[model samples]
Target: MSTPLSATFRAILMRDIRLAWSQGGTGTMALSFFMIAVTLFAFGVGPEPQVLARIAAGVIWVVALLACLLSLDRLYQADYEDGSLDDLALSPLGLTGVAAAKILAHWLATVVPLILIAPLLGMFMNLAPEGYGILLLSLLVGTPALSLIGSIGAALTVSVRRGGVLMALLVLPLYIPTLIFGVGAVDAAMGMVGSSANLALLGAVTLVALAIGPFASAAALRLALE
Candidate 1:
C-alpha cells in the first residue's frame, strides 16, 4: 500500500535524522564549534566582563551563522553521491517536500543544539540575565531562517567539489537580516528600543525563508541533477 504524503514526510524526516545521527552527530560537532568559537571570541576580546557582555548576543548570532555553514556541504552531497538524491527527488514527497524535510532535519541537527546551549555559552560571555530568555527566543525564532536559506546554498553546491566554502560565500550575504534582528531582539529585550519590532521582523524573515526556501532549493537540486 502507498503511504500518505504526511507519512512520507515523517518517514523522510526520521530517516534523515537517523542518518545525521549515525555520522558522528552533527549536533555535537556544531555545538562544539559553537562553544569553541564563542570561547575564542572571549579570549580574543579579553576578560573584560563589560566588553564581553556588550558583544555577547551579536557574537553568538554570528558564530552560529558560521557554524551552520560547516555542515551544509553534506546536506545533499552524500545522498547525491550515493544515488539517494535521485530517488528522493522522484518520490511522492517530491523535491520541494524533500528539500523541506532535509532542511528541517538539518535545523534539528545543527541549530537546535546551538539554541539550547546558548544560555550556558551566554554565561561565559557575561550575557545579561535579562538577555537569556530573549536570546533563546531570538535564536529559536531566527535559526530556522538560517537552515531554510542555507538549504538553497546546499542544493546549489551539491554537485560542486569542495562546495562548503562556496556555500558559505553564497549564504553569508543572505544571513545578515537574521543576524541583525536576532541580535536586535536580544538588545531590545535588554531595554533597548524596538523590542517588538525586532522580533516581528525576525519572524517575518523566517516566514519568508520558509515560504521561498524549499521551492528555490528544489529548483536548484533539479538543475544540479540535470
Candidate 2:
C-alpha cells in the first residue's frame, strides 16, 4: 500500500537525512567548521576568561551563523540540478511539504550537531555552568529560524549559478533578530535580568519563520522550475 500523508512526510524527512549522512562528511564538515571558527575566535581574542565569558554567547551565535552559511548553497542546489526537486514537486505531498521537509532535514543534519556541541565549546569560552542549559535551549529555539530563513535564500537562488554570495547578502540581514535574541537568552541565563523575555521573543521569531518559510520556498521553487 502507498504511504499515508504523515508517512510520506516522515519518509521525505528521513530520506534527506540519510542522504546527508551518506554524503561524504557533510554533517562532520559543518561541525568541524563551527568548531574551528570558535577556536579561531579564541585565538584572536587572547586568553582572558572574563572576556571570554562575556563574549561567549555572541561568539557562539556568530560562528554558528557563519557555519550555517557554508551549507546553504547546497541545500536545494543539488536536487535542483539533478531533477530530484522536480520529482519531489510531483509527489502527493506537494512542493510546500517538500520544502518544509527539506528544511527540517537540513536543520537535523547541520544545526543539531551545533546544538549538541555548543555547550562544550562554550565551556572553552568560560560559559558558566548555569549558562549551558540556556545556551542549548536558546539554540534549540533559534536554529530553526536559521534553517527556515536560509531555505528561502536557498530557494530564491536555486537557479542562479554560484549564488552563495548573493544568497548570503540577502539572508544575513534577516538573521540579525534571531542572533540578537539567541545571545540575549544566554546572557539572561547567566544572570541578565529579563532573559525570559528574550527566550519568548526568540521562540516567536522561530514561529514566524516556520509559518512563512515553507510557502515562500515552495513558491520560489515553482518560479525557478517555470
Candidate 3:
C-alpha cells in the first residue's frame, strides 16, 4: 500500500525537526547565536536603561534575522548531499511538498524558540513594558516570512559547497522589509507610532512569503537536482 501524501508530509516535517534537535543542530546553534548576540549588544551599549531600551527592538530583530540565517545553508544541503533529495523529489508529496515541509520545520525548530525566549531578551535590554507584547507579537507574525523567504536562498545555494555566506548574501537584502516592519511594530507599541498598521504589514509580508516560498524553493531544488 502506498503512503498517503499527508503522512509523507508529516514524516518529512518530523524528520527535519528531529534532525534539527540533534547534536550541534541548527536550532541549538541559531538559539545560542541569538542569545549571545543580543547579550553582547547590551554589554557593548552600556547598561543605561534608556540606551538599551532605545535600541532593543532593532537589536533583537537584527540578531534574530542573523540567527535565522545561520541555519539556511543546511536547509537543503544534508538531503542533497545524502541523495535523499532525489528520493524526496520522486515521492508522492513531490518537491513542492518537501519544500513546504522543510520550511515549516525550520520555523518550528528554529524561529519558535527565538520567539519564546524573546521576552527574556526583551527584559535584558530593558525594553519598555508596553513593547514586550508587541515585540513577541511581531516576532511571531514576522518570522514565518523569514523562514519562507530563507528557503528560497537555501534551495538556490544547496548545490554549492560552503554556501552559508552566499545564502546570507542573497537572503539578507530580502530580509530588510520584514525587519523594518517587525521593528516598526515594536517601536510603535513603545509610543513611536501606532502599531496596528505595522503589524498588518508584517502579517502581509508573511502571507506573501507563504504564497511564494514553496514553489520558488521547489523550482530551485529541481534545478539543483538536474
Candidate 4:
C-alpha cells in the first residue's frame, strides 16, 4: 500500500528524531556549548551583574545562533551520504515536503533543546527574570525560521567537500535579521527602548520564512541531487 503524505512526513520526522536521540550527544553538546559560551561571555565582559544583565539578551541570542550552526552540518550530510536523499527525491511526497519535514525535525532536535536550556543559561548571564519569559517565547517562534532558512544552506552545500564551514558561512548572514528581532523581543520585555518594532519584524520574518523557505530549500535540494 502507498503511504499517505502525512504519514510520510511523520515517518521522516520520527526517523530524524530517533536518529538524533540515538546519537545521544547532539542535545547535550548544544546545551553544554550554550552554557560554556554564556559563561565565557560573562567572564570576558566582566562579572558585574548589571553589565551581564544589560547584554543578556544579545548574549543568549548569539549563543543560540552558534548552537544552531553547530548542528546544521548534520541537517543533510548523513542523509546525503547514506543515499536517503536520493530516496527522498524519488518519493511521491515531493522535495518540498521532504525539506519541510527535515526542517521541522532539525528544529525539534536543535532549536527546542536551546529553548529548554535557555533559562539555565540565562541565569549564568544574570538575565532579568521578567525578560526570561519573553526571551523564551520569542525564541520558540523565531528558531524554526532559523532552521528553515538554514535548510537552504544545508541543501546547497550538501554535496560540497567543506560543507559544514560553507553552510555556516552561507547561513550566518541570513541569521542576522532573526537574531536582531529575537534579542530585540527579549530586550523589549526588559523595558528597553524601541523593541516593539523589532519583535513585530521578527514575527514577520518567521511568517515569510514559513511561506517561502520550504520551496526554496526544495529547489536547492533538487538541483544538488540532479
TM-score of every model versus the real structure: 0.97, 0.96, 0.98, 0.94
Write one digit per residue (lDDT tens) for candidate 1, span 132-206.
988998999999999999999999999999888899899999999999999999998897564789999999999
* 115-197 per-residue lDDT for model 2 (tens digits): 99998899889987888888899999999999999999999999999999999999999999999999989887787575789
- Candidate 1 structure, TM-score to reference: 0.97
lDDT, candidate 4, at 49: 93
- The segments of candidate 4 whose C-alpha lies over 4 angstroms from its true place after superposition are 192-196
| lDDT (CA) per prediction | 0.90, 0.90, 0.94, 0.85
**Which 10 successive residues of model 1 have the least lDDT summed?**
19-28
Off by over 4 Å in 3: none
Runs off by more than 4 Å, candidate 2: 192-194
> Highest lDDT: which candidate?
3
| Candidate 3 pairs with clashing backbones | none
Give the least accurate 10-residue stretch of model 3, judged by summed lDDT.
Answer: 185-194
lDDT of each residue in 107-226, candidate 3, tens digit only: 999999999999999999998888988899999999999999999999999998888889999999999999999999988888867899999999999999999999999999999999
Q: Pick the candidate with the highest TM-score.
A: 3
Q: Considering lDDT, which of the candidate structures 2 and 4 is the better prediction for this target? A: 2
Q: Of the candidates numbered 2 and 3, which has the greater lDDT value?
A: 3
Backbone clash pairs for candidate 1 read: none
